[model samples]
Target: MSEQDNATLIEVKGLYKLFGSEANKHMHLVHEGLSKDEILAKTGHTLGLKDINLKINRGEISVIMGLSGSGKSTLIRHFNRLIDPTEGNILVDGTDVMTLDQNQLEQFRRHKMSMVFQRFGLLPHRTVLDNAAYGLTVQGLSKKEANERAVEWLETVGLGGYEKQYPSQLSGGQQQRVGLARALATNAEILLMDEAFSALDPLIRSEMQDQLIELQEKLHKTIIFITHDLDEALHLGNRIAILKDGELVQDDKPEEILLNPATDYVEAFVRDVNRARALTVETVMQPQICRITADSISDALKQMRKTDDDYGYHVTDDGYQGIVSQETLEEAVRDDNGDDALCEKVYEDIPIVAPDAVLEDILPETINADYPVPVVDEEGEIQGELSREAIADVLSPDQVPEEAAKASQPTAT
Candidate 1:
């Protein structure tokens, strides 16, 4: 795909929505700082969204989260023009959705986007295969072609061999799989899931979330997921948009929301969040580090003696070489028989982590580990190092976790 298509698939500018006959006329009250209740009492209009400016990037899950009546559901419907905005522009792939006529809108929904409903929305009389092929059939594919495409997606969603079963015969999770298969069968560029797993059992919901994540890795479809649950949003969203009383309160990554909530309401939502699962190794790693390019064991030992720390990273201009402890170099200087390779690397087996690895995933590696963890990028180059002390600080009850927005970026000395 072109870079432009992958940047921002949807962009909402100056968006506002209110439920009343004269909703557009009452928008000035919202801009004047009138609360939702006040507007309802004075203008007889219930505000759904007000001045919501957001960008939903391609190939990422952008979650819209809010409590009941917070307009999250209303906002999502506006994407496909199911509910028109009272005021503002909704741009999808650089085309204003409001400008599309009925025929154009129908074609847009069929080709550009597909939705998975929360209630599974499966036709009861149809078999699983027919239900899964619903979208393809709607798009005018023949039964033979639609069924073949649906079968592949059904298998992909782990519902293989159940094509003949009716919706009533399958479990809730299985029925949801049918819904997901139907959405994926169309091969649309965008997937809209509005609280898709909220009705299932807790365990089933968790499993579906995992499956969705796995599917996203392979398909890379732009997804807009709606959920009220903070845990669900944190788990699924690459970027989260939190709403309160129809106004956007916070829009940020999960770690930023946890570390530095934009408002009190957002803070309350993330107050009890487990830091280990939400944060990654990238946030805690110190990238601005000292590296020694020593050519000899005596030279390496002399360089290490100047630093107060016990260890040093041995790296060239290209990338990381290895780590050397002052004690190891001291021993090497005394024991080396004029060997040139002595200054190359002290230990071959050291704990290392990827920048994107969650802290929880790498917690066990740090336990009783004598060495500092090296942070490596995807290009197999070392970017930074992580210390156990840094990990403990965030986990400590007495320690105030560093501001995540600041911590995630490199600090200039």
Candidate 2:
């Protein structure tokens, strides 16, 4: 998981939920080490959740994922107190949700949290703009102000021209855009999305995932998304919480889960995942140990020779410039007499990968590039370098087929 500061946005502690007419009566059975099936068979009470302890940080997407009866949805409902916990507490920014009165809970849900449901929960009679502005309107904003804010968010979610159309008129994806626009229009700090994109077709689902990622980069809303799809969890989550039989089995970042699964259940979820797409350049990059300025041609060549490498990165006060090949430096030393000769020899057209760029994206560049690809940040600052060997190391399987491993090697050009 990402190293979050002590500042926690939502803290769920010892949370348990039982579904039955006399649920509270079965609390002792739960305390006595009764299994979910045993408790259900004896008391006719379903254990919706058991001792769910999680700390949701601010401005991060925390995904809850599991199979059909895994209680993933049940865990999220407690965030906004949609379902009351049979025992334990849910503290939102230090306020116990279980203690909130009806009025206070209503106010909290209106201003602090917004929900996007799987069924596109848009009212068929209300126009797109009205549905988007529903939260603002409920909060007593004037129609003019509410519509203005809704229009801006609708445009933000790519639904600008559909403001006057009804939900029945728009396609499934467009309707979900309206749903997102509705959630965004509220300006709620916490967003609870329950399989919000699951209803869409595969292509539209991918697009919505991309859109959510793009929006999160700009908005940074504290989102708690629920999904059974492991790919969706891996793609959208900054942290993922996996539930199994009403209990949390693991909670961790995507790469951590991929590299070190907590259990066989998690391993099964990740076993078929394309690791290259899940791992980023930051995960495998080496420190940029060999670097030289444009003025240091001889020094750069010496460093390259000592390291047994053919190239070194050209850097400046601003950040990274590009790669400098030993051949370029040797030619410059032999032909150019000027002090700035080394500067002219620096290859400024070298390939670059961003720190956040996935390994799958970097593979093509690494395979084709003559020199090691420099991993740069948004400001063009060189963070590290990635080699073809490093790529192969990360992609190597634990139990590789003999011929497959041999065939996977990149041929020299």
Candidate 3:
């Protein structure tokens, strides 16, 4: 939904999983609207997943979330073929996972995918460096080369000096950092994180989430993260899939899910979420049509009159200069001053916000600003303007965009 390129990395099609001796015989019962309780009561089969179809884009974080028995953990295992589906196709980079031979599956897991578990799965006897290097060592790399790679990743995850320490010596957060270092040390393209931060305390969990986001900006690995927490899902997932009773109830971008919930369950999940934190300036920014160059006093006044606005943004070839007021232009004309003198009258102390900044952070600046806050990029080029009205529109539930409404609809498999 965030303008992803037409490249799908993982594709799960018509996936179903049933746990019982005679699972195949109860397929018809599942299709006939039988509940999970009824299915288990009658046939002694536990349905782990049903008709699960998803397309995970390359280098994006796809979070699968649900409650305890919602099948989120059961669903992620299918990605690495740790658990085989009763019926479905698991395609990774266009290769069918189910068709892989034992050796091929082993190769795939070793070379292509690296997993970070809820529990710190580091070897007890191994030092942090040795644990981090384990994956590379298993792949037949020399000790020197593997340790070098592991050290680099360990430093990246903020554990440079702790390489000599054992897993028992580290705190839960630090141990998870080691686990992350180990996964990153492998340099695998696909990262499978199952409740990776759920084991940490709230503060540590939040820190790890921030660390992962920062790392993802550079690594760009295709990540499949599992979580039962909706807030965590919304924060980390580029796309979120909600499961209920072993079935996919909804899948969409987080903003779409928040703005236009597809079902009552999703609505309840989003009801208390802080909308200001979820919505970015890009979602509510208006076009910067009222703009003028420093030399164009006449043009500035005319444009302000046309837009019925008192201020206009003054921009130079370098980037944003400041805001120009109609009163300043009028006085400059009355004094018959030159363009240089008029340019000096432009107010350069205007409030500004980055396009990616959330509304919660933008509120303080906009609330006290005399004019709409200018939304600029890294280059200081003005992209749009965020007015109070635009912010209100975004907060209004009925004013959600039609595109977002359509995006919230379930994908047809």
Candidate 4:
């Protein structure tokens, strides 16, 4: 109803849930009426989630993580109303999930959202194609149309030829593929995946993770994935929420969570993250810049030679824009002086990464480019510079000594 509410696809406010003890069942009794000692004495129950407040953005993958009994799974299950909250509101695109009647809940589950479970909940009696189309069939789709959609989704999940096979006929990985296809076939805007790959072997789990990423790239569906695996959480979650006893310990982008953890609990989860691999030059790019055109290669080269940052200099049509570099300057100078249409041969179409590009993406582009790549904006305008070495520090943070620490140390003390 409000602008803030519209920006949030899903919102939970002052949520509280406690198990056991009928005398203290209500949220108020649990959250406001009793202290922790009193609740333990009366209910002999634990708070599954305590005053949990969250907002999931549209078209983003938000991960919920914690150890067993931490409520990550419970919280995600609440999104589609699989488990009704004991208290507080679960709003889906502004509608209150708690208020949905059985029919409304069923319709919401069938048409508005779809979920993938860790167990790969496929019907053993059904063929892979039929399993994949189960959701569509449940919604009253024609068998022909449902099967057709199933086939298309099966191919997308790399199971095109396995359509006729039953769940028992497939491997664990293959069965999970069917589950993924089934969830996808509904064409829902929001997807809830609860440890969808946890049952697989490590190798298969990694492969499934890649598949999930590729699928997300194509579909851009908003997703909330629940996993206890820290690596998987980092790899998949655009933003992560670390839940401890149902309380939110941290909610932030992966890089921020790693670099600026809010609590010891969250820090332990991020302690081993390869921040370089998880980040991009785009994350650290500076905005202040000047632009020049290719026609003024001489002038651009001169400016680049004087600049100290990774941004060599920006290049544009009317005038040059972005960061420039010595390598770029020399390349431009040499090419400008050369005879054969050097301008066409020298410029590139590949996106120049920003300073924020993580070392993982940077190293490959650097090795390929043989120099720092130009950082560009969404409009394809050169903004600054991104270098292999700058990326290397992220990749090899241990090797790169802290300049601030060095500068601050007492001389020979």
| TM-score of every candidate relative to the true structure | 0.89, 0.89, 0.89, 0.80
Q: lDDT for model 4, please.
A: 0.75
Clash totals in order: 0, 0, 0, 34
For 40-76, candidate 4 gives per-residue lDDT tens digits of: 6766766677778999988889999989978898888
- Ten contiguous residues with the weakest lDDT in model 3: 399-408
True lDDT of residue 94, candidate 2: 82
Question: Model 2, 173-291: lDDT tens per residue?
Answer: 99999999999899999999999999999999999999999999999999999999988998999999999999999999888888889999988888888778788889878987777
Estimate the Cα RMSD of every predicted model relative to the unseen true structure.
4.6, 3.7, 6.6, 5.1
TM-score of 3: 0.89
Clashing residue pairs in candidate 1 are none
Error of 4 at 140 (Å): 1.7
Candidate 2: the clashing residue pairs are: none
**Segments of candidate 2 deviating more than 4 angstroms:** 1-6, 304-310, 325-341, 344-350, 396-413
Which portions of model 1 miss their true places by more than 4 Å? 1-6, 303-308, 315-321, 336-340, 343-345, 348-350, 377-379, 396-413
Deviation of model 4 at 326, angstroms: 8.4
Between prediction 1 and prediction 2, which has the larger lDDT? 2
